[model samples]
Target: MTDIKDLPKKSGPSGGWGSMKGIKRIHAESHADPAAFDTLRRQNKPGGFMCSSCAFPKPANYKPFEFCENGAKATLWEQTRDRCTPEFWEHHTVESLKDWTDHELESTGRLTAPMRYDAATDRYVEVTWDEAFQGIAATLNRLPADDVVFYSSGHAGLEASYLYALLARLHGTNNLPQSSNMCHETTSVGLKKVIGSPVGTVIWDDIDATDCYFFFGQNPGTNSPRFLHWLKELKDRGGKIVTFNPVREQGLISFVNPQSPVDMATGRETVISDQYHQVRAGGDVAAILGMCKAVIEVDDEAARTGGELVIDHDFIAEHTTGFDTFIDFARRTHWSDIEHHSGLAEADLRAAAAVYMEHDRVIGVYGMGLTQHAHGALNIAMLVNFLCLRGNIGKTGAGVCPIRGHSNVQGQRTVGIAEKAGLVPMDKLRELFGFEPPQEDGTHIVDAVEGLIDGRIKGFVSLGGNLARAVPDQKRMEAAWARQELTVMISTKLNRSHLFPGRDAYILPCLSRAEIDEQATGNQVITVEDSFSHIHGSTGKRTPASPKLKSELEIVARIGKASLPPNPKVRWDDWIGDYGLVRDLIEATYPDDFRDFNERMFEPGGFWRGVPARDRIWKTESGKAEITTPPQLTSLGYGEKDGRYRLITMRSNDQFNTTIYGYSDRFRGIEGTRDVLLMNQMDMAELNLIKGDKVAMVSDYDDGEDRRLGGLSVIPFDLPRGTVGSYYPECNVLIAISHHDELSKTPASKSVPVRIERDGLAQS
Candidate 1:
């Protein structure tokens, strides 16, 4: 009929005719009404709902057009009219739905009402909210609190997440693992240890003032396109941009400003990166070591010439400790090792380091690429080390920015959504909530999965996420999920997780950020803190997708009251009636930052929660910034071996975390299917595999079952030799639950050692 959707080419710049075409195509979908789309336009204006896309700071000043392509897609996606009503569930079995792809499942539309699994029918039958809550409460009350894992996602606002965490603690369990456990936990774990603070220390204004911008492992064009405007401005101001990643992402290469009508009309684009180094997957530690080494040599050479030394000696002596040890370690690290591991030549590394040396105000940017690894925490430490060496912290246009993967993910942690104690502190909780929280740390996602597998965990309550699909080792996770006695998903739409039912399961449909939350008090606007620590309130302009749907805050409060009856100390009813009381609690808890939370949020674009690290304030045990030597290079992954390639899992351009917008990944020039593995052209040729050949890949892990991925199309791509790439959730099969950062327990989804063999074909 039509040409196959497999068209692989060098991806062109973003935000031109292609973006317009994409917008037109998306809007043309039968379910997205034009009038509703126009209605959403006004919502993005002043005093309107915040875009639930990326957590990039909303501009302090307003523009007529505020959201980007993906943001619009997210809006339309939530506001889709393709109803998955009770009748739809009546006709389709869960087994039949399982055959459908993630795209088909979500596109089925916003969940209309609560659904409970029927064992005999093998389907989710629509049920009343009271019936669903009663069933959940009965099962939950029957189980031990320690066996319950209360999880949150990026979708929930601060009020919901805070209430989620508080409910868990009140129930006498600290097992509150959210999306951060899967995405940016490493940044939280590492940055707190290094820079004396967990959150990023830079504001949105820093992007414009930065002289040299280093994007370590992020692709902002697809993840956070608004950031491209800042990059374009930086380039226009004669600033240099360098990127170090395993793949030469199109976003990092060039971008056309959608805001600039002239550029879009003329098809003119701005080149983003001046230098890009294709580091081998899992080689971030080595790459950082190499950069550190080059900077050391450059500084020495500058000193020998009787010129200004590149190293900030005064800053190192006064602001940082362990500089001498780091200096010695970097100097001793061999160039051969760096070159071998990073796949970057000595000259390229030197040139990158020279760029850093050339600028006084440099910002280091990184993403999940650096965090979803075995040495993720170490990788974060190295980036901080690099920035601190240049007197980056507590200065204008200079700091480490760990670009997070989801909106409001950082805020969840700020509102005390941690597994460990001392973060929010038991004393603080006691004083704020008038009750004592659990003293010890609880389970991470990995540990929670293991608990389920080993028959330790009995219940799981999800605030808003597809845990079964987002988790590593889907097979194992699904199996573990099946064993739970009770499972609950408080979500806006149906996803893969709802299908993997436990003995008793309930789906509590909740309101999306795009839908108005009308409570007993009044219409409520929830607050979320951005990646840059910008806090703002979002007021949904549209009516509820379904009249039966409850806001996440309401869903959480109901569950809390049902499962654990209101204690005299904590008035659950009060917080549920008025969200302002929730803000009051938050302000009372973290008074220093959230003192004027309500007043400031109602202001233009909210307020910036200041960074302690930016003021030369250290909260470390030693009260000084510390830069220890990075872990050995052997820690990256299984080293090079014949026919053994490193596999890194990534999200397609059209996807957001676990939500599939479409089957096509237009940015990477692929469509229709996601069953392809991107391999280096030379690696494919060496393995005697063609572009469309099917292959079976086995992980290097010694498990007898052989963590294997079968029937995958091999697509030749532009990547470093000995490295291959595949989409996550599919390739998540290869990642062992145990394979994670030791400190953070974040699944090492970015790097895996694997071997591929031709399937039912002879060598060409």
Candidate 2:
């Protein structure tokens, strides 16, 4: 591989940070082989492997090389020739690997064996599959069902997630905390309260059909590249794209689709957003409230003129309740307060309101930036209010679009991976498996971590994911992992999670989605649901990295077999032998949308699950859309009295959730480093800090807990006053587990209160 700086910068959407630069470097370091491209293309064809990155929907009718840069990187990453064998483990101990960077750990390549950590040697030693399974089962069986927590990453396929949920339920524990709990739990919780559904109501085609697209706290370029194509098309058709974010993303400014030969040859880029407004961090609710207030203003004016303008009077009267209360609240909110809170000009808010008034249908799209804050759930509720004001829900080309991160995270939840006991498909599970599923409420991600720290959870089993790095408060998280009696990780590659060894740690390598999974029945194709609720097939095309590595299905099944006695109560082996059997169980368990899982997945674009609110048929207890009030804004002032700067955590374009691809965030002008913090020029000027000044950030929590992360290079940039942005996981040390969403329990990652000071200074 070539050096990160030596790589030629690819002209595309903005937000190519650390790993993005490394990916471009890799592309430039080597030429694409036609044979390799063709093989990858063939493998990526519909009905084959799902894109291992974002869950952006692909048109069922279209069959083009439509994959994005990140998708290509994900594909090439798994296709690499690297390997991590028993010899590699013999050379490096767990303590030694802990010193390695995240990129270095994963770049070592795939794990080639089932390994168990030997406490004495402090190194991973190869173990037989039976012995590993027996050990895992023994540990799990020793703990109370509630004491064993099961965590799943979104990377797992629908088959694997379903099997995982089944395993957890079969063990009589509802402790299934998934990746969605950390990311989109706000969307799920907020939408369920208002619209009676968790997933986005809009489809890919809805972008082209809508008159207005409202983007909130999402950077499409780096996060969901595939959505850019639709945004480009929407712009070409003169449809309005309005953006609300803290930073001005390059993708939102203009994007040149590399796939379009004509546009690429002409060096022409399509402008995306018609209107862009920068809402300060933790200001999404205020911004959304401003929008709703403007709508109300327009409605009142239209009423005075004896006209029907933006307000959907008929739909509101028939489909929604609490309009009077919502209007009253909106009328009471002062515009000055909205402007101050939103950091948006009153004219801009009114302009956006005019667009909302002119458009018949509007769609609101959001990502983690909107959902990972103190008022995340409220932000979601306010967006719903914006849509509800225009009667956009349950309609074509209009609704809430929560762009999920993991490909199968939403699907996993759909297949009974939730903590809420009432949400479980109990009747179906009982009828199909002849065993009553657990009806007790389970712990979410935050709850699970707390349980671990509190000594309530003894055993940990992860079907797929890097839990240690993904969770907040890295020091506490690592300590919690160490406290666990036993920890089992079923994954495709080596990650930071493996380094934090438990009393008994077992790492089971699994097959990637790109690899062929041939079972006793036949070759199987797993299914995945995208952000838009479209389910499709994902069948691996390449051979396993190593024959010893088992598929997630196989590992989960083996563990289940070892843990549970053979009985006709559940067809665990049958489902394991054939992925279709698992799908069959899913179909039986959730007959509403997945009646014919196998047959439907084989269809052109699979099937879109039912979204009740799409038809304005809200399943809320009130039988209508609920109008929620925004929480009172309590000022959480930044910086300490010692003249330290406030630190906000963020992701580089090149990185995914916690997996670091490489160092260099091109859009942010950062290169060869992840330990740098982006600071405002004015803030630095006031603090007498220079661009290359070294600093250490510490938490400003009242408690005297030392939450300091040292060795950061301050880079002066265009940012909000008294605000500083640093890469996550590194800055995660500054955020405590206690600093989370009050309602959703999502860590306030975007709004951490920290104080940055000169490297060795007790007080700068």
Candidate 3:
């Protein structure tokens, strides 16, 4: 008999009983353990570690219950009472455990000690920490420097990622890639080209100041629920919340403040979106062009009629350049093309523009929806253009917020975890750490995966990430590991990647962000930067789950010492023992940015790593804001939309990236299972598909390989016609690695062309 998932018939407001159930699920998952409760309390308290969930920065003033629903799940996932001991591995071989789901693997529990692969036994047996480190070093030292790829995860805090990148550079390769490559690389690359900084221009307070805003390609309700509170507050304060996406997310439609017991009990949900437009996948650039054209036309008409012009002429003329060129290009971009591609009417575009032009301050925000496409960078640049038209950037309630995926993903890049070799100057690195950092650009996730597949890269070192599952082409990437000489993971728990061991594999168990990390110096306090560039310190105060587990800092330092030739002059030991020295060195390298990094850590609310773009200090090559031409229709096309449908992969409310916390998406009304596809009702009707119709999606690309996902049932959704949605990692298999944004190299995970056919045997 087939597994019938508990599909909730009715979808309601995001944050009422549904959120309560999520909170309950978290508590129940932890088995109502007092330690989990205590751990959360301590983690949320002042002077405690920041939540390692999504990168929504914590408020400066601490709250006893600052964590969100997913935050609780994240902590519970890390601090679970379950333990994976050596004896546990003896019972389940890696070959046997290979079929287990990603959730099952992580749920196996935190590793109690280091483990090494046993070829004959096909199991990972316990090994000494020294052996793990030495073995990692030996493997890397033996391989060609470029053959080793170092990947970083968002869950990895700022300090750990920094040290991880440094160790990789010390090992003499720039083959460093991280979560940024998969999510916000477009934001960084695009913004840096114009604004001179690859970061969001707005701080948290800007949310309150803006009177009107649009979230293009973002649904904070599921990805960032805590952000929904802010969105609710914006609406409560008479601010307009406009949304543009292929699927009209329920969270954007309305929300009930989970923290407000009165609203939660009364079943009162506040309306969130003033305007919602269902733009198709890869249609964002066209939509943005339409908006700009509308604003320009309005200004032109107002000028001719002797009415007040709506454009922020002063801000545009003084703070930015190339506006006239942008206007010319936007005018040249035809309304019909935009309408055809975006599935939006000119009237709707003008109405949204009316809202934008009426407001003096507007904050524009976006996520992976904009960044994971062929013209992703252009999509981001065009967004900056929208804000620039109204003088929004660097204003009180006006700026760009590139909503990042991981808590410290932005923070890692801040402290020096870059794939580009010279990101941290070799002169500066040698002056501080006494080593010549390589000068060639390194492999990002896509390049790393390609290298691994082609046998060019034989060793892979990941700092707490499920790379095999997270990347596109799941089967190919997973099998590519077999060709590797060695694979090492410095992580707290076992994941899908661990099960796919290479010839030589090691699991170096490290402490999570929730546990107390006592170094030789004392209890170490690590710093993490938020999406908005606020740097804060997080000190995990709970007792370690296993005394055998070492801090991420310790693991990196040990590996560095063993891997690199002895250089007593470089205080790797001191930096490892005391993070303050590391911060001091960071300040030494980035004197202006981290002037008083150590002292700032003690600030009541974290200090800001100010963006020059927000301050009107242009850092671009032109010394002013630069604008790009509106994307050509070719860059925004999805072949012929006859029988093929545009697919957009998203995260379920119960999931975070590849980490599947649960099977249900409470927000989307899908429950108890992930083996379902969310297709537009019209599309489903056209295909004669019904709910629970077993089908397999076939990729439209002629990639020689038959890329397909079989036995997925179709479920109707409120999405644009010819567009469909499914949770990522599950759908990641359909996206070809070659299908990526040319500029940022980010996988076009959000938009993939596919066609679905009913599975006869499965239906039978």
Candidate 4:
């Protein structure tokens, strides 16, 4: 049915005429009208809607075409004319729809009305908003508050997420498992331990002034294409960039800025990274360790020879602790272990260290590559140690920047969508809401899924996300999903999660960020925090896709009103009438971050949520930045052993997280399919397999349960030996739910030890 063999390999720079065509094609396919042009104009501008594509902060300087190809896709996806109304549902049965691909399911279009699953008819029947809300509340009130988990996606704005969290806490539980727990939770936990802040210290201005940017496991070309414009500027300004990833991403190599008419006209490209080191999968820790070792050893040499000091002794002594122990551990780590485990040479690492030594202002940028590991927090901790040796933190253009996915993920966390009660101001919430919030740490995604299977969690309420597909252990999750007593989804479109209805299920239609949210206070503005911690307001310009659609704020408010009993302090009606009241409450809860929220949020480009770490104010217990070493210099899961290859899960250029927009991954030269695996030619030769050979992958774990995928066509590519690459979510079945970061509880989606076998035999 699919042919990947004939797919032409994508070469040259990313973002050229290819991007222009991509933008045009998506909109054309979505049947966008002429007015869509005006809509695109307002994207990422002040008093306009924010791009929900990626969480990269909007640049202070705005351009006419600020949106990227993927942003156009996201916009058009929401503005689509296709509607999955009652007529569409009446024609298709749930069993029949279950066989549809994720792309096919979402492509069916937007859900126009509230729907309730009918077990007898095996279909979804349209229902009124009152019926849906009351039914959900009835079930939620009957169950123990702890038995229900409130799940949120990054789609919801800050006000909606704040209201969602408030509702859950008022309902007497804090089981708010969100999408952040699956992606960048390690960044929060790890960075907080060292710098006392859970997010990056660098702002847009810092990025503009940075001397060097070291990118690890993040591909800006695909996930956040808008970032490439800044990277282009950084390169043109003579800044250096070093990349550490198993696969050579096109985005990291070079870029053709479509905004530059001269470059686009001449077909010229600007190089993005100075050094591209193809580190083996899950080798980030070892690589960081090796870098530290080089910096330390070179500094010792400088001391002996009276050369220039590479390590900042003054900064270290004054602004940090545990440097002595960390340096000792770095010295003890042998080069052999570093080279073998890191899949990088000693000279390469030293060269990278030299680059680091040459620059005073450096930014360590990473993505899920560093996280999504068994020891993800430790991986991040090692990176921090590397940056700390040169006093990178608390500098103008230097810090650890975790490139987060989802537009408002960080914002959601800012408003208290977390499982850990301590992360939020519990006493403040109690005082504001007149209710004692749950004190116990509630379940995260993994624990929530287990709870669903074993009956600890009887109900699930999702703000907006495809939880069924986003999580690991898909097979197990599917079965567990069916066991839920009540399930409520507040979303704009149909998704795979809608198929796995619980005994009592409701799908409530909600408005998109692009659609106007009309409340009693007239048009409303919602806020989101970008990766750089810039909190800004977003105002929708489009009419609601359907008249029945409600804003996320309205849906959350309605649910809160329906579920919780009358409380003197909690006023859901006021929030529904005006979102400014919600901002007032948020300001009260997190005063330091949200002070003067209403006035400042709608300002030109929004205000920066203050980061104390930027001012050399370490929030750590030691009162200074902490330099720490990993428990061991092991691969943390990257080393080759027992003839098993490390499988790194990735997103195609055409895909974003779990949302598949199309079949063409233009940057990777993959077309019409996502079932192909990228393997090294040497590895294939050793196994006596040729290009295009069908293969099967079985996770090499002794857990007794067989985690396997079949019919993956192999494509030869340059990868570290004993390492392979595959698209994620589809291959999520290979990852065990239990295999996750011990501290962050983020699924180890990047590093799975697996054995590749010949197709038919393995399948049989």
Candidate 1 lDDT tens digits, 1-764? 00112212266677666666666666656277455576557544446787777887777776677777777777777788777888887788887888888888888888888989999999888889888878888998898889999988888889888888898898888898888998789888888898888878888668767898988889887888878888888989999988888876778877888778899878777888888788888887888788888888888888999877888989998888888988898888888988887788888888888888889999999998899888888888888888887898889898889887777888888898888877776677787767778987899988998888789998999988899988877888888897889989987778999888999999898887877788878889799888888788888767777899998998888887887865776777777788988988888888887988877776666687778998889788878888878768634645566767788888887778888887657777778888889999988888877889998778876456568888888888888888889887788888888888878888888788788877544332
Tens digit of per-residue lDDT, candidate 4, span 1-764: 01112222366578988888887887776666456677789988888889988998887688888888888888887788888898887789888998998888888778899999999998999999999899999999999989999999999999999999988988888899899889899888888998899998888778888999999889898888888998888888888898898888888877899888998999888788788888877778889899899999999999999999899999999999999988888888889988987889999998888889999899999999888888888888888888888888888889889998999999999999998988999999878877878899888998998787677888999999989889988888887887899989898788888898999999999988988889888999999999989898999888777899998888988988988889988888899889999999999999999989999987666798889988889989999988886776643544446668889898987777788888878777888899998999988888888888889899886577788888899999878888899998888889888888888889888888888889445321
Predict model 1's lDDT versus the native: 0.82
TM-score of each: 0.96, 0.94, 0.96, 0.97
Candidate 1 pairs with clashing backbones: none
Quote the positional error of residue 113 for candidate 2 in Å.
0.6
User: Residue 652 of model 2: what lDDT?
Assistant: 80
List, residue by residue over 158-203, the lDDT tens digit for candidate 2.
8878888888888998998888877888888878888888778997
Minimal lDDT window, size 10, model 4: 1-10
Candidate 2 ranges beyond 4 A from true positions: 1-24, 27-39, 633-647, 762-764
* Residue-level error in angstroms, candidate 4, position 744: 0.3
Q: Lowest-lDDT window of 10 residues in candidate 3? A: 1-10
The window of 10 residues in a row where model 2 has the poorest summed lDDT is 1-10
Instruction: Report backbone clashes per prediction.
Output: 0, 9, 1, 0
In candidate 1, how many Å is residue 253 off?
A: 0.9
Model 3, stretches more than 4 Å misplaced? Answer: 1-9, 42-45, 633-638, 760-764
Candidate No. with top TM-score: 4
Off by over 4 Å in 4: 1-10, 635-640, 760-764
